[model samples]
Target: MDKDNDHGKNDGEQRLESGEGDTMRAEGRFIEPQEPRAEPGQSEEQAGTGDHATPERLDHPIIEEPHEKPEKRTTTELLYGVIANPVETLRYVAKHKLVAAGILIYVAVAWIGAFASIPGSLNSFEQIPEISGLPMFSPRSIIVFTIVGTPFFSLLWLVVYAGILHLIASLLKGKGEFPGLVSAVGFASFPMIISTPFSLLDYVMGIGISLYGLISLPFTIWTIVLTIIGVRENYNFSTARAVWTFFIPLIALFLLAILLVIGIIALFVGALSR
Candidate 1:
C-alpha cells in the first residue's frame, strides 16, 4: 500500500510538471463553449440554423414607410401650367383623374368664345350678298345652330383628334394609352381659350375676319407646339418621333379639310348650275 501511494503521488507531480491537470478537473478553470461566429454574408437567422445553431429568440418584424399625397393646384394654376409648361403639366394630367375638369373648362371656354364670335361672324357674313341670300345664314339661325350644335361638334372634334393622334403615336411605338392622351390633348386646347379673349377683342374692336385670323394665328401655333410636347411627354417619344407623330396626323387632317371644302364648293356649284 505504501508503494502504491508513492507511485500515485509521483504520477500527480509528473502531470503538474507537464503543465497538465491530473485526472480531476481544476477548480475555477472550467471553459464554456461559445456560439460559433456567424460566417461572412450569413444572416443571423440563417447562421442560427444548421451548423451554427443557437438559442432561438423572437425577432421583431421590419416596418415599411407610408406614402405621401400629391399637392393640389388651383384652376388658374392648372391653366397657366398647361400654357407655360405643357410637358410637365400634361404629363401630370395624363396620370391624374381630375383631367376631366380641365377638359370641361376648355370646352366651356371654347363654346362661349364661339358664341361670342358668332355676332361678328354673322355681321361679316351679312355683308356678303350671296351668303346673306341664304335663309340658313340669319343671326337667329346662327344663334340656334351654335346653341344646339356647339357641344357636340367640340366633343366630336376632341375625340376624333385624340384618336388620330393616338393612332399616329402607336405606330411610332409610343407607350401611352388613348384615354390619357385624350385628357392631355384636351388640355392642349387650353391655348385656344387664351385666344378667345382676343376673339372677343376683335368683335369688341369690330376688326374684320382678317385681323381675327391674324390674332388667332400665334395662339394656334402655340397650341400646336404644346400639343407636340404633350405627345412627347405622355408617350415618352423622342423629339423626331413626337414631331412626326404630331405633324403626320396634322397634315392628313389638313388635306382632308381641303378636300371637304373642295367637295362642298363643287356641290354648291352643281346645285347653282342646276
Candidate 2:
C-alpha cells in the first residue's frame, strides 16, 4: 500500500509539470509579433511601416521643392519691347514671306487695273493733233509717275510696315519666339494697301491738289509707331531706345535722298556739257 501511494504522487507531479509547459507555449502564441529587421544600409523611410505612417506625413519632404511664380507683362510693356527689337521684327517678316509677297502682288494688280482705267477717262480732256509740239498723252507717262512716286511713299510706309509684320509673326509664334527685322519688313507692308486710296484719289483729282497727303498722314504715323514697336520686340530694348530707333530709318532715308539728288544733278550737268 505504501509503494502504491508513492507512485501515485510521482505521477501527479509529472502531469502538473506538463500542464505548466503547455500554458507557457499557448501564451507565447497569443502575444503580438515584432516587425522583421531590415537589411543593412536600408532606410526606415523606405520600409514604409514606421511610427509616422499616416498619409499626411508619409510623403518625404526632400523630394519636392517649392517653385516660384513668373512675373506678368503688361500690354504697353509688350508693345514697347516689340518695337525696340528690329532684327527680330525682320526675322518674323521673313518667316511669313509668302503671305507678305501675296499682299504685294495684290497691290500691284490693283495698280495695274487703275492704269488700265485711266485712258478712257483721259479721252474727255482733249483730242490729239497729228504732231503737237507737246509730247503725246501716253499711258507710259502715268506708269513713269507711279514708278517715281511709289518708292517714296513706300519708304514712308516702311515705319509701320516693318512693325506690322514683326508684330504678326511675334504674336503668331507666341511671345516666346520674338521676331527679327525681316519679319518687321515683311509684315508691316500689308497696311501700305491703305495708300492705294491716296493714289486713286490723286489720279481723280490731279495729284498735288488732292486730300491724299492728309489721308496718308495717319497711315504714315501708324507705320512709324509699328516699326518702333517691332524694333523693341526683336532687340529687347527699353522704351527710350525704341523711340530713338523710330528716327534712325528716317535719317537714313533722308541721307539717301540727298545723295540721289546730288547724283542726278551731277549727271544732268555732265550731259549738258557733253
Give the number of the best model, judged by TM-score. 1
**Clash tally, candidates in order:** 0, 43
Q: List all candidate RMSDs to the true structure.
A: 8.7, 14.0
Off by over 4 Å in 2: 1-137, 140-179, 205-210, 252-274
Question: What is the alpha-carbon lDDT for the whole of candidate 1?
Answer: 0.78
**Estimated TM-score for each candidate:** 0.70, 0.40
**How many Å off is the CA of 243 in candidate 2?**
2.8
- The TM-score obtained by model 2 is 0.40
